[model samples]
Target: MASFHLVSLGCAKNLVDSELMLGSLLAADHRLVDTPAQADILIINTCGFIQPAVEEAIEEILALVAVKNEFPEKKIAVVGCLVQRYRDDLVAELPEVDLFVGTEGTAGFADLLAKMIRGENPGRLVLPERSLMDSTLPRVLTTPPFRAWLKITEGCDNHCSYCMIPSIRGPLRSRPVNDLLQEAVRLAAGGVKELSLIAQDSSAYGRDLAGADLPTLLQALLAETDIPWLRLLYLYPSGITPLLLELIAGNRRIVPYLDIPMQHVSDPVLAAMNRHYRRRELESLIAVSRQVLPDVALRTTFLVGFPGEDEEQFLAIEDFMRQHRLDHVGVFAYANEEGCAAQGLAGQVPAEEAIRRRDHLLNVQAELAAARQRQYLGRTLEVLVEGVSAETDLLLEGRSRYQAPDVDGCVYINDGTANPGDLVQVRITDSQVYDLVGEIVPDVGLAKEKNTARG
Candidate 1:
């Protein structure tokens, strides 16, 4: 059996695709390796979402090429969005790569590699058109055993002027509700306690699937399984319906957290970006969410310097964030992607200006995050242990229901000795900008504690 190593870069969606590819290869009796140097085949699942991401992908490919030079017999392959976007150009520029596969062609990776091994050229394998084949493919889970990302939909329909997702990923296509449930059940059965529902636009889920919506799907998941936490990620602001809020408020399993990517708050910027919501409408939605779920963790992403975004617009976004005091915030400097509508628009901000705007917004968010975290001080919270801290090996690292993995901060448990998957109560002792320091709560019941204190 040939040994291979796959390096996945970008969002959870790309990670899911890589997992599916890995599973297919493993099923075909291929051995998996940790590094490119140790493998006979190297596959890179790349991202071409933005300029920085594209540059990172190219750097990775070049590093692999250096490895290939050292061991001329080993082969290298590139797959995913980068390949889909720049097929012929990549092939021409990076001749060291032996195989090139696109996003739609990833499902046939094993067969493609087999052909390459047999001396077939297998040139560029970009699909002529997008196909929604919900492969019941196996996956070699790369995440911690306790948590796994369940991709409910593939591709995106929204053609945001600043985004390249639609052109690179094609139209929105959701997996059937039954298929998603089966996958969730399988993951849960395999010891996954937390399942984060992920997609390009999770709120737009089931728009393609007749008689299905996100809330309905959530209800089905709650009724069908017993996963400890069902967190929703990548929900759009415009789709945050009253029904959805009510379902979240009532459902015990669904985490009271939403990752809504509100790109910008200014009406002009929103219109230029092709987003449907304006400043007032977004404020109304936030007010409604706060009214319904008082403690809901609102995580959002904002684009700081899009084409035609002025100083006033930037300040408006900053003011909006300050007013909301969001639980989590991600600020991105806009990049002019080729073929995007914003590419041809006038009034492109200088790179320095973009950086300044991004930094200023981030500073605001840091202060807000610290203040929000302070509110939890001395309170006991349920935390899922994810790993042991490297800085202080005795301390355990984990996240509360309010924090998502990787993107959000984690809580540090200083007192308790717990396993990776154990859910334990921890008393918050201190708070930082993006993390919490806590001590594990003792097992002594509240009544016992009062009696002991009295004695």
Candidate 2:
């Protein structure tokens, strides 16, 4: 049994692919190692969504190739979107990489790895069908036992001019509801308390499928799994129907959190990026969400300095942010990846100006996030314990429905005796720009009962 080390990069969706690869390797009796130096085979899952990501992936791969030189027997494999995007180029440029597997070729990972180790050619490129894998596929959970990401769909349909996802991952392909339910059941059975639903565009799920949609899928998942938290990420604004909002409002397990990637609020920018929704539509969507679910924590991402983005367009986004007071906001300066439609677009914004715009938006959001957190002060909210705080062992860190793992802030529990998966009520004591300080509410039932008695 050969030992191997795998490095997974990119979004949660890509991480799912990496986990599946790990599961395949384990099934093939390959041993997983902690470091590249200790492994006989090394795998690097690359991301090529944008220029910065591509650079990072290349740098990491070069570092691993250097490690391979020290131990000549170590086999190297480069897989995922980066390889899919630049297969021939990478093969010729990086001869040290024994195998170059694309996004669709991950299913045959075990066989490919085995063939390469035995001095057999595993083919320079393997591009299979552009579809999602089934629940029956082997998948080792790489996340904490308490939380797991459920990819309900694969690829994307929306050809956002700036995004390379459609070209890299292919068109939208929604997994069957039955298959997803079985996986969710397994995850819940395996003690996963939080199930985060992910996809390139989750709101676009079921568009290609017959008699299906995201709300219906959520209903099935809620009915079947006992997972405490079911959160949705990467939901495009276009497909967020009223039924979806109603479903979220009705279910307690379905967290009152939405990650809508409203790239820009200006009409001209939206039209330029082919976002499909205008500024008025966006405002209406936010207004309806606030009306339907008052406590809903709205999270959104913005793409600043896109081609043709001007000072007026930039200020419009700031104005929209001020008007909405969104709970969480992420800003990224656009990068013109080759092959994307935006690459050839006129009026390309300079890299330095993009950086300035991104910084300005972030500064504004910092103040907004701090103010939004203050609203929760003196109130009790349910938080899922993550683990010991990175700042100090004395303090434990966890996330409320408002906070997504890694991207959003955390709730620091000052004094709490609870396991990682335990869902406990916490009383907010202090607030920061992003995080909140809270203490686990002792005798939660009793506190509620006392309040009832007082009422």
Candidate 3:
């Protein structure tokens, strides 16, 4: 039984993959160590969506290589999107890596590594299969026991001109409804209170499946799992159906939180990027969401400086953001990556200008988020305890139903004795730019508590 360590990078979807790999190794009786230096094997799950992500992954690999050098017997493997996207290129550049596994190749990693360790020649490059993970697959929860990510689908079919997901991840593959529900049941049984449903485009789930769709899957999950909070992420604007909206509006367990990645709001830019929805459609969708779920927390992402995105177009997106005052927004400058259709497109926004736009959007959202936070003041909210606050040990930190893990803000409990994974009621007392300050109600029962927060 070899000791192994993992460095998982990128989005929650990739994190799920890392957890699966970890679970597989653990089931095989391999021990997990805290650091690479103490492990006989080190694995890096990488992201290659953009140039910056690629560079970040490469830097981490190099750092791990240094660690491997210190321990000559330690083996290193690099896997995931980076390997899928740049297999040949990475192999040529990173000859020191013992194995390279892509999205599809991840399933067989444990056996492949075992062969390599046994002095058998397992080929360095693994070709990924076009498939989706089901409930039968093993996974070790990486998130806190109270919260877990449930990736329901794999790959992309949108084929946006500016994106390369379809090429790297292959076509859309939805997991069987029974499979997802079984996994959720297992998670809930293990004390998971919040389950964030994720996919390349969550709203697109079950499109390729027979007689199945997102709403149906959601209803099944709600009926089967006793989890307290079910959040949805990575929902494309165009895929937001009326039935889905109705389901979200009516279901209390399904938190009123939406994460839609609206790349841009300008018609011309949208066309250039091959986004299916128009400006009007996006506006209508937002309006409908607001009308249906008044208290819904809308989280979105905007890609600035796409090819041919002029100042006027950029201003349009800014105007839309100002008008909507979204609960959470992520703004990113475009990176022209090879293999993406946008790479050779004309009128590429300059790097400096893109950075300027990204910064401007971020500043705008900061103020908007601060204003949104002010609403929670004095309101009682259900907060799932995560752990001790990073800012100070005197306070415990967790998130409200409106706040998704990691990407969204957190609520710092000024006075509470609740343990991690426990859901407690907290009354908002103060607000920050991106976080909330709260205290457990005086009468609220905790596993351990001595006095009221005001005392």
Q: How many steric clashes between backbone atoms does each model show? A: 0, 0, 0
Assess candidate 3 and give its lDDT.
Answer: 0.88
Query: Which prediction has the highest lDDT against the true structure?
Result: 2
lDDT of 2: 0.89
After superposing candidate 2, which stretches have Cα over 4 Å from the reference?
443-455
In model 1, state the lDDT of residue 370: 98
Q: In model 3, which regions exceed 4 Å deviation? A: 442-455
Q: For model 2, how does the per-residue alpha-carbon lDDT over 1-455 read when each residue is reduced to its tens digit?
A: 79999999998888999999999999999999999999998998889999889999999999999998888878899999999999889989998888889998676699888888787886877777776888999999999999999998888878999988898998889999999999999999999989999998898888888988999899899788777789999888878999999888877778889999999999989999999999999999999998888889999999999999999999899999999999999999988888988898888999999999999999999999999999999999888998888999999899998899979999999977888888888899999999999999865573343212111
- lDDT string for model 3 (1-455, tens) is 78899999999999999998998888888898999988999999999988888999999999999997888788899989999999999899988899998888666678877888887977888875677787887899888788899999999999998788899888899998999999999999999989999999998899899989999999998889878788999999999988888887777778888999999999889988888999899989999998888888999999998888889999898899989899999999997889889999999989999999999999999988899899999998888899898889999999998899989999999887899988888999999998999988754543332111211
RMSD of candidates 1 onward, in order: 4.1, 2.7, 4.2
Residues 364-445 of candidate 1: C-alpha lDDT, one tens digit per residue: 9999999999999998887889879856888999999899988999999888789998777899999999999999886555
lDDT at 416 for candidate 1? 71
Stretches of model 1 off by over 4 angstroms after superposition: 133-135, 442-455
In terms of lDDT, the poorest run of 10 residues in model 3 is 446-455
* Full-model lDDT for every candidate: 0.88, 0.89, 0.88
